[model samples]
Target: MSQVSLVAARIAALQQAGSALALLQATQELASCADASAAPVLVEVLGFNNPGAAVAAVKGLISLGPAAVEALLQLDPVNYGARAWAVRALAGIGDVRGLELLLDALGSDVAASVRRAAAKGLGQLQLDELPPDQKQDVQGQCLGALLAATSDGEWVVRYAVAVGLELLAAGLPAGSPERQQAQQGLLTLQEAADGTPPVVQRRAKLALSRLELQ
Candidate 1:
């Protein structure tokens, strides 16, 4: 089949609620085609309203290695939501180049959702696994960003920042100051957790438990 047709077919399958693993495979295949023309299709499918589809798309893009970065980068933060998921996939792929991109997005992006995704991506990147000094730097950067976001007028932004902080704490050393600080942030989030979405609340709880602070 032609590249265009193949790409369209895959996207249609995704929209039809195809298997997550299959969609992920197609995402990588489409990304590897190196055809920017297929970007819109991939983005549309990747940005499915369903979180499951979104997660699969990100995983697929990550599997494409570096070639998917440019396509992933071109997605609009507000309209697509792919930018946020892209950061996650990139980080999961273990590419540190995404580190700078994620930081920039979290610090400057207008969309709270995107910024939240970036923050969570940083945690998934295992920034805490870096050398102590490097880990400190990354943690400091995220903390500063989260602090600012928490003060934003948007409740969603506040919640997102809280989630990011909680995730960051997961990999910290036992009884470390950073872990303690993150636990405090999670506690601050607890009061409003009931009002937030169940998934968000669950994530906060998981992160808190990971730190043994629950």
Candidate 2:
């Protein structure tokens, strides 16, 4: 069979999956196929209650890269599950097209894991292809979001904030204000003792050290 036919067959299997295990298997196969045409089906699987299937779908969407961004953006806003999974896929893809969604998720998503992924995604965005002014503006936005997210109640999210700060700073000039602000944010996280988790503090300290070395 042709590759297109194989992908279609996988999509059909995913659509017709009658059991949890079957859905998982079909989603896995489709995701592994990494066909751009499978992006919609993979995204649809994110709305399902099955986590295993959703994980596979996220992988598939990430594999599709920027081609999957529009479909992910169009996911039903009411379906928080799908949105959360979409955030993860966008984070993994690190496409600049996902910038707004990642910022919103980091600042307001109720799910800590989603916020964590968004924080990381904001830092990892591919900005090299953009014009210098646009790149700086986007980096500034990401920096502000990561700084705000440092105070997040979840330790995991805070840890991700540290990560985001480091990544964003790394792309800026050594003495640039944005880079300095990012370093300051990391320092604040590192010194936070007011209920901050030790792990988060350690991660922040490590991020600060790495930034200094750069």
Model 1 misplaced stretches (Cα beyond 4 Å): 1-57, 65-88, 91-94, 192-206
**Candidate 2 residue-wise lDDT, 1-214, digit = tens:** 9999999999898889999999999999998987888888889999998999998889888888998888898889899989999999999899998998999999999999999999999999989999999999999999999999989999899999998888889999999988889999988889867989889889989988888898
- Clashing pairs in model 2? none
> Residue 180 error for model 1, in Å?
1.9
lDDT of 2: 0.91
Give one digit per residue, the lDDT tens place, for model 1 in 1-214. 9877877775665556467666666666555565545555655665755576576556556656656566666666676465666666665554445777777877777777677667666665555347779878877766666655555555566566666776677666768887777777776665454355555556566667766743
Angstrom error of the Cα, residue 194, model 2: value is 0.6
| lDDT of candidates 1 onward, in order | 0.64, 0.91
Query: Best by lDDT, which number?
Result: 2
TM-scores, all models, native as reference: 0.57, 0.97
